[model samples]
Target: MKSILDTVARWLPGTPEIAMVLGSGLGAVVDEFTDLSVLPMSDIPGFPTISVSGHAGNILFGACSGKNVLAFQGRIHMYEGHSWTEASLPAHIAAECGARILLSTNAAGGINPLLDPGDLMLIRDLVVPFPLPRRWYVPDSPAPVARTGFTGFLIDQKLADDARDVAAESGLPLRQGTYAFVSGPTYETRAEIRFLRRSGADAVGMSTLPEILTARKCGLRTIAVSAITNVASTVPEILTHEDVKDQARLLLPRFSRLLREIISNL
Candidate 1:
């Protein structure tokens, strides 16, 4: 099968400044865009199928606050048996389509005590369980550097600062913290939740890491946000994906507004 990069390249809709990934129930943000064009992910020749609920599984081209955007209304995941490259395909496509920034959003279980359902947490950094490939350092740099002792922030802080200004100006509450990425079709156990909180994760989710890493590798400045959909507690409280999606739905209008304004200024 031909790569969808070629397909997207041929029919690219706009010169988008940013590429946005809408995660889980977060996909509805594209509805706020003007001059929107929609393409189902299934229609992209080599694109993978989406099995998760609440993901609309489409690519959206539109303008948010007058800035042209290429937004993916859904995303692939490593938990879905996709490779790291496959999970991050949207990020790669966004760069190929001429986007300079990547803005990604997801629904996560709050790992921090102060965070609650319905809060929007800015991803200041990420914590993953294992090593990532060393080949990603921005585009057109020297050869991909070997993994050194570079224990710096992987997610861009400048972009995070931009979002902070936007949130403050909008009078919307925002939480800034670290996000933990895990491969899962299951929720975390109490021990797992404890481990993550200890490791500095304020929110936990199954997606976003691969996408963020890929976006950075392609020279796209990246910003990630999470809709804290539930609290991953030390107590074994039963939670469902449906519950997570419901909370994200409730957060949509407010989250959408904040995200739109941030995109305008970026």
Candidate 2:
């Protein structure tokens, strides 16, 4: 693994202060960087290739809003037939590459009534489903329970405040909430959405949790934002990947600007 990191370092050749993982329809945010060096995930040893729609499947190293950064154009997910450890590899590699901060962006379904499509929500905390592998989850019982409690890094309050203020000034609707992660290649059913909302989740997505936990383990400061692509209510409307992609495209610029300003201020 160290050798794999060494290989990527040879290709990218920089010590980035910040590392980012762009999710789903959010890959366009990478365009904000100058002097970008694009590296296909396949070209990087030990990196997972992304196959989902709306993800660019590349790694970028460059200057964004005056800071040296390494950005992933897409990410692997547990729901994509990959294990949680496999899904977390990129974030671990980013930390090893010397990133002081890990910033992630995703397109999620709004579960909170206050959240609407195109809203940008800053994730203050996360709650993941249990029964995870022992390597990732810390058992709660003396009987050596395989499942663990919720685990992920909480974004610093100061950074969260800065993000909220920036979004407000930019006229972007910014909300804060607990993000929930589900293993998914499928969209949630109306009943499932209702249950998650009742459980206190504001947004729901397939990726981010494993990556967040990995970044935390590696001592990287982490912050995440979700671009709400749709309201996950039991409204009987057709929900498809196409719709999610379309919504993400519509909200890309706003998401990009919010991230750009936040990075600059950091």
Candidate 3:
């Protein structure tokens, strides 16, 4: 991990205070960068290749809204056969690079009644159904910290407020709620969605939890926003990854604006 961190440090032009983890089809936001260096995951030591569709698999260093930012153009998931630690390496690397604020984004199925496709939800809390696997032992590095409670300070409130304020000023209505993380290569069934809704989840997805847990342990303040890509199980239509990709692209402008404004406020 140290060697990987050191290698990434050398590639950085300057330390970034803000870091973003781009999810699913949200990678298009990287195209907005002015002075940028795109580092492919394949070039980074100890990083795994991203295999999922709609993920661009690169680390972008540049300025957005006049703030220095490190944007991860893709992310890994546990369902892809990576351990939680491996799935979260990007956030840890961002922390090592001196980024104090971590902004993560994901495309999720809307479980709440009010949410529709293309709507954005700010995660005030998370409900992870899968037992968060114990952090993997890394050579010469301290073991990762365990969260004492499920929702103990996962997303910082001040950061959430700042984001909301920015959205209000921009006339973008941002929904706030709990995000439930499921281990998935498969999307949820109707029964599962009903259970999650009963459990108080507003949106559901397969990513974000591992990375958010990793960011918290690394002492980086975190905030996550979910782009509602599809209605989960409520509608009779079959959902497809291609449908998720399409909706995410359609909502890029709102996502991109919120990201830039959030960084500016931070």
Candidate 4:
């Protein structure tokens, strides 16, 4: 895997200081970058393909707000039937490519009372349920279990403040929250949503944590934002993926602008 990333890095013209992962409908943010060169995941050796809708399934190299950056237009999720290690390849590759900072975005159901649909929430912490592999989980066990736990890095306060300022300047609402990652091809049931709220989760989603853990392990400073796509715990209706997609589309422009401002300021 390291060899493959090395080969890919050789194909890249320069080292990027920042790496961005586009989540859900947020892929449009890559359009704001200049001098972009896109490489499809299928074309990159050892890169996992994204099977879900709203992900662009490619990597874009360009300048975002004066920073040399590499942006992934999509990401693999645990719900896609991929192992945690497989889903985290992008972060590992990004680290190997010399990015010191990792930025990620995702659309999630808002569980925090103060959040609303279309609001952006900065991830200050993550609470993960599964363990990530560490070569092997137990002595004498032939198969290695993935390592998993709380990722210790917090988002840089200056960056979070800058993101908040950007949201305010753009008239987009911004909030802070604990992002919850669930293994899912399905939306959470109402009872599950209630349980998450009781567990103190502020937002809920199907992706982000594994990538965050992987990024921190590879020595990159990580920051993540969530676009609130639905009100999970309070909504009376059952949720569907289509609902997330529709709301994400409605929120893309503002979300894109907020990301642009944050990246520019960084």
Which ten residues in a row are the worst by lDDT in model 4?
Answer: 136-145
TM-scores, in order shown?
0.91, 0.89, 0.92, 0.87
- Name the lDDT value of residue 252 in candidate 1: 93
Model 2 ranges with Cα > 4 A deviation: 130-153
RMSD of 3: 2.6
lDDT of 3: 0.85
User: C-alpha displacement of 19 in model 4, angstroms?
Assistant: 0.5
lDDT string, candidate 3, 1-266, tens digits: 67778888999988898899999999999788889998888898778778999998888899998988999888887777777667787788888999998899999999998999889999998886545444334443333333434446789999998889988998988999999988787889899899889999999998887778778878999999999999895767788889999999999998898888878899
What is the lDDT of every predicted structure here? 0.82, 0.79, 0.85, 0.78
Clashing pairs in 4: 131-147, 131-148, 132-146, 132-147, 132-148, 133-145, 133-146, 133-147
TM-score of 2: 0.89
TM-score of decoy 3: 0.92
The digit string of per-residue lDDT tens for model 1 on 194-261 reads 88888888999988877787677778888999999998874356888899899999999999988987
Question: Clash totals for all models, in order?
Answer: 0, 0, 0, 8
Superior by TM-score: candidate 3 or candidate 4 = 3
